[model samples]
Target: MSLFSGSLQKYGQIDILVSNAAANLSIDPIVSMSEKALDKLWEINVKASIQIVQAAAPFLSDGSSVIFVTSVAAFNPGTGFLNMYAVMKTALLGLTKALAAELAPKTRVNGIAPGFVPTRFSAFLAESAEILAEIESKILLKRLGTTDDMAAAAAFLASDDASYITGETLVIAGGAQSRL
Candidate 1:
């Protein structure tokens, strides 16, 4: 069975939806990036979230929450290598606001922009001691973020505690110059 059907069968109703799928298919600059890589990035990073929301919209309960796992790169691309990934994440920022407006008064939509975390997805950032140290030095906390840190923010957004919150992307980047 599909995930939607399986979820409905198990839970009866969908209260919280978190669209966290992402991909960085290429590290090449935008000008040099291949069409296939761009397509893959768009498919996994942006379109997948929209598809999930579309499929789950019918089953989402009243006062339900929808959270998107955006990236700090949305606001600050940092370097050329990450430009395309940042562009896709920037699209998600817009998607979050638009979806929040579209689903308001019943379903809330928000997002979290995480900093450099040592996950397998971000292991490249920590591969070299010099690079890791440089990154950590830039953070006000002087440390990389943890999965627990991200989970806490997500849990808060998903819970009733954040009832008044919507259409906002929280930056959990340890004061890493995310915004102006």
Candidate 2:
């Protein structure tokens, strides 16, 4: 909140809002997942997103864009130990849908689901070259994603190119299956 408030105070208004902060707090089975860890995960992945949107709402107006960085896990439910992560990402989808309606005809709301990005946040999967290759093999593009790729998609969605697109989750997963 402080960072956002500081930015708002500095800029007075925001043209685009992207809620991309998330953490993999736990990977244990649901039966063994700690309550504290669960709360922390929910706080970062879901609650913080809502809070950011509310804080930025006053500055947003028509033509403004709000993009939530969800994940392919939201579309694919059975992602092994990422079940909880998947659930949280799915919650973002719901938030996107509802917020689109609430802020409609004004600020546009959308989401992007990037798959197997080789970022520090996904070190669990991208830490080893072998694992990265294995994951990339699953993508039709035969490669892992990059931050720039995600940024390009976001730029399009945030620009006038996607002015008519709202309440939709765009999948930038290198041709990964995203159908629910």
Candidate 3:
């Protein structure tokens, strides 16, 4: 982030902030989780993101878009599986709306809850090549998600295309049902 701070200030007045940094641990139940593990997730996944926003808030221009790369765990709350990681993602929704209200009519801050994309974060879900096929059976698309799929959404949210949208969290979960 220091690299971003020192450098990219010249990029179109930094009208867009793609808060994509995150941390995910393998599936673990909360009962046996250690305080150390919980704190680490909150620090890196939650507070770190908020701090990034705090640092960039001053530089963000009106009409800018800040997209937080959040997770479906926020809504699903199998918060048990990822310990504090899920809790932090859940908190991000409220955070997004709060910041949006505070910075409204100016910067448009939003979030994206991506489903189980084929990334290291999800490596814990499946180890076999056939595992995705097995998991895809539950998702309507019958396929896992991709980073590009998410990039396009973020692009739309950050570009002038979504000028009227704000304080909303877009879900990119391949048709997975969401209660939010």
Candidate 4:
């Protein structure tokens, strides 16, 4: 069975949907990147979220919440290697706002832009002591973000506590200068 059907079968209704799928298929600069790599990045990081939302829209009801997981790279892509990934993530920010307007008054749509966390997806950032220290030094908290930090933000957005909030992206980057 499909995910939506199985979810509805077991839960009766969909209340909260968090679309967090993303992939960084290439590290090459945009000019040098292959079309195939660019397409894959667009497919996984941006298109997938839209497709999932389209599938889940029918089951969503009033007071339901939809959260998209974007990244700090959306605001300030620090390196050229992340240009394409950043572009896709930036698209998600626009998608969050557009979807919020599209699904207003009933289903709320928001997003979370997480900072550098030492997950397998971002292990390269912490691969060396010099690099890790340099990154931490830039953060106001002087430490890398944790999964728990991201989880807390997501939980708040998904819960009734954030009922009045919509179409906003909370940046949980420990003050890593995501924006000017």
Candidate 5:
């Protein structure tokens, strides 16, 4: 928070805040996962978001937007490995809605759930071309999402183009199933 505070002081008020920090540790059955791992996931994926929004709220005013970069895992639990990550992402959905209500008529709170993006963050799932191809096949778009894709969505949400949108998450999973 100290760094956030310093940034606020240095840069002035914020127009858009994107909370995209997350750590995806080992994935296993709930019982098989260690307590420390679970705690780390909760701290980074969930608690950090709460702290960020709270810290940024004062600097954000009417028309500002807050976007959380979640994952399709929130709605579709991974075979079993991503159970912990999925749960924490799911919690962000609730936080998005609640914060939207709290900052309503002024700031907007929303989430973006991306699917099978071949970034280092997701390298664990797409370690090879064949593996990535197999995963992309499931997406209707037949391609992995790109950072540009997410950036476009975030830009729209931050602009007047999405003035009327709030308290809702935009699913950019390339037509993958993203419902709870």
Candidate 6:
């Protein structure tokens, strides 16, 4: 009901709605990630997205934007570590496009698929500083991502400058396996 409250409080005047919340239980092979794992991921990453969009739809004005935060793991089947996490992210990409089409010209919708940003979500990968440094070594930039990197992209997409773009995904993988 945060969605409903945000709408009610905003008084049907939302300029932008960004769904940035996510959750991940464990990172193992798909065969090992079980029903509970799948259910938890679906609840947070998928259902909540639709629920919040439904809540925010009434508040959004024409030309408003909706940005869904996803991950490069969607296309890049991350490590064996991603498991169900990667699948949910991939589903998010589809959801972004589907929602964009559903919203149409009134509201522009897009997604950002960022690489490994250093955050609590990825703390699982770096249980310790040693591991964190180890993971950083693999990135094309020779460093992991920062929250600021993602913030800038989202800010730009939601801004009036991106008025013509919709149903697209901007990847922020630090030159990690990108096509020219």
lDDT of each: 0.92, 0.89, 0.79, 0.90, 0.87, 0.82
How many collisions per candidate? 0, 0, 0, 0, 0, 0
Residue pairs with colliding backbones in model 6 are none
Clashing pairs in 2: none
Candidate 2, residues 3-115: lDDT per residue as tens digits? 46776777777789999979878888877999998999899999999999988898885689999999998998656788888889999999999999999989999999998
The C-alpha local distance difference test score for the whole of candidate 6 amounts to 0.82
Candidate that would win on lDDT: 1
TM-score of each: 0.96, 0.93, 0.88, 0.95, 0.93, 0.88
**Which stretch of 10 consecutive residues in model 4 shows the poorest summed lDDT?**
1-10
After superposing candidate 3 on the true structure, give the runs of residues whose Cα lies further than 4 Å from its correct spot.
1-5, 8-12, 129-131
Count of backbone collisions in candidate 6: 0
Off by over 4 Å in 5: none
For residue 117, give model 4's deviation from the true position in Å: 0.4
RMSD in Å for model 1? 1.4
Residue clash pairs of candidate 1 = none
lDDT of 5: 0.87
- Per-residue lDDT of 55-151 in model 1, one digit per residue for the tens? 8988889999999999988997746578999999999999999999999989999999998889989888678999899889989999899999999
How much does candidate 6 score in TM-score?
0.88
Tens digits of per-residue lDDT for model 4 on 121-147? 988767889878887888999889999
lDDT of 5 by residue, 1-180 (tens): 554678777888889999997898877787788999999999999999999888888889679999998888898765557888998899999999999999998799999988877788887777777777777777998878999999999999888999999999899989987898
RMSD of each: 1.4, 1.7, 2.5, 1.4, 1.6, 2.5
- Candidate 6, residue 104: the lDDT equals 90
Global CA lDDT computed for model 1: 0.92
